[model samples]
Target: MPNNKPVNGQKTPSFFDLIDQTPPPPVLELDSKPGTRRLAKLRAAWKASWEEGGFLYQRWEEVLQARHGSWHEVATWIKAAALFGGLSLIVMMVDAAGDIASATLKGLSAAPATGAGDGGGLWGTVAHPVQVFLADQAAHLAVAPAALYAFWQLAGLLGLIGGFLGNAGPRITWVLFGIGTLATIWSAAPAGGRAAATGLAALMWALASIFALRGLTLRPIVHNHPPQYQFNAALHLHATIPAPTPASDDFGDETDNIHPLQR
Candidate 1:
């Protein structure tokens, strides 16, 4: 028999007593049903996705609200417009290049033979290709409306550049862009499936024109009225002035000395 008595105001330790004092291991209760487990996982994923989407929307709203009436906002709009305009210009250039290449190839393929006594001299050799290329281009232009559309795009590109460089007037830029827009729309009739692309190009040109006009008008005003700090002479003089005599009739008046009556 083991002795079970208090030692120094503490109970004597025993194996069974220690076992009873120890905390039990936590029992994990897992759902055996796959449906419930899957539902729980789906619910958790949805909640996380909702929270992330909300956070993103909140940040976007904050960004949109932060820069109103600022130069940064104007710059962003101009940059966006310029980007679209540049893309449109690139597409136009590529289309023009393709057309020119096709016409040149066709002309060269159908060039006259350079046989003996065929008047194919040094000058003829050089001028023959040029003549053929120009003839091909003219024939294609006569049959297709691409010539006018290409001219419009070229003129609009020049006007856009000039406006940005401050070398062109607003009215000229507007006219060029207007002509380009109409040409783009007119040319779209020939582009069966590519009409959407032409419309986008026209929209880009319009956006560029609008923002260019706005920038041209706003830049001078923004540059002219710079922020200025107005110095208040009275505020600086407050510390230097002596305290007023409590008994003086014109105690707080700084100009009392200047007036003979007050003095």
Candidate 2:
């Protein structure tokens, strides 16, 4: 009789087998056969990748942070730029008006002294002198280069500053935005209304730019943890992550592991 009973120290059936047969573990496919040569190549590639990938990831994160920092800093600059632009435009208008008025008064004052000799003489002499003076003055005023120059120069400057400050601060940016919007509208006004409208438009643009600046700083608030994301590493802080689902028996269980995060 062959041995009907099992030999001593023989392995027993697994618990799962007693209930129902379990499937064999699946084999993993690898790029190379198991050996020192394969491990050497893998190790070399991993080392190189770790060095390069870590550097690249860190640089990318740093670049993102720097961009955000620059944007925030720019917000403050916008408000100040808008205010300055508005003031500049106002000054140009006042300067031009004063120049025109002064030129007119000087022309009138140059009327002749002989005009005082007779009731009619005063009027007659003064009229000729005033006319002559005004003709010369008219020649200068005809060009009106100063007004045009000042208006265009200041108007352009304001437009530039307003554009720059458009994303700078909240209140000032709003002000600048208003100024810009109004200025744009005024620019298209009728010819007779153009000068004043143009000035107003410049002023509006500057003011509106301030508000636009503030808008640039606006970011959607995030309130979830890890409130911000860090890349290429595990989060170390106490925070919530999507809970992992229970794996099936067919899927082998793996331990939950934690790793350090580098900021």
Candidate 3:
């Protein structure tokens, strides 16, 4: 330690003053290290996901507690089923639309040839091409049927969404599903495997329709409510009694009746 005495009326250096004079330690650049930045980003993402998941879990817990014995759980499952069914319908619709588009484009590309080398009038030319295009569309039997199927699928998807949001009644969804199931079964080939697969699909559609109807019916009844509590008479009986006041000579027995035991 250096000498602490002041020289020539100079003020003595305190411990804090000495600390202030000390140089700060060099700060290491953690970001300069390989993989440090990537690790930090991953950690931040994980922390955010964890927080979000915890929040969702807490909300789910609250819902379960508030609606413990209600039909809410059944309704939730039905909605989930409807969502999955809608996804399937969407996929089928996309496939059908693709087929229709491809067929239509092929017919149009070949349309000019059908009207070529004709000495007919302008009306004849237009009429001839339209007829040819219709004939071409008729040749691909699958296209028309696919278009119809796609339309029904779209209708069913819309009904499912609308019913889920309470914008449409359950009957509409049920009707669409019923139509889709019938069409699916009707279109099934007589072949063994194909018929079996189509039958399975129709069964699924029927089940979805039933669940959708039930879910919509229960929607109004399956809502959250404040927890109900009943008054506990037994708890009131077990409550602690008040202590008795001490008898005063000046106010003899003035408070004796206030205590239940003394009374």
lDDT of 1: 0.50
Please, what is the whole-model Cα lDDT of each candidate in the order they appear? 0.50, 0.45, 0.51
Global lDDT of model 2: 0.45
| TM-score for predicted model 2 compared with the true structure | 0.17
Clashing pairs in 3: none
TM-score of 3: 0.25
The sequence of per-residue lDDT tens digits that candidate 1 reaches over residues 162-214 is 66666657448666666645453444223452454445555655677765554
18 Cα displacement, candidate 3 (Å): 65
TM-score of each: 0.23, 0.17, 0.25
Top candidate on lDDT is: 3
Candidate 2 lDDT by residue in tens digits, 173-214: 345435544444344345574565455555545554554444
Worst 10 residues of 2 by lDDT: 15-24
lDDT of 3 at 91: 100
Model 2 lDDT, residue 119, Cα? 21
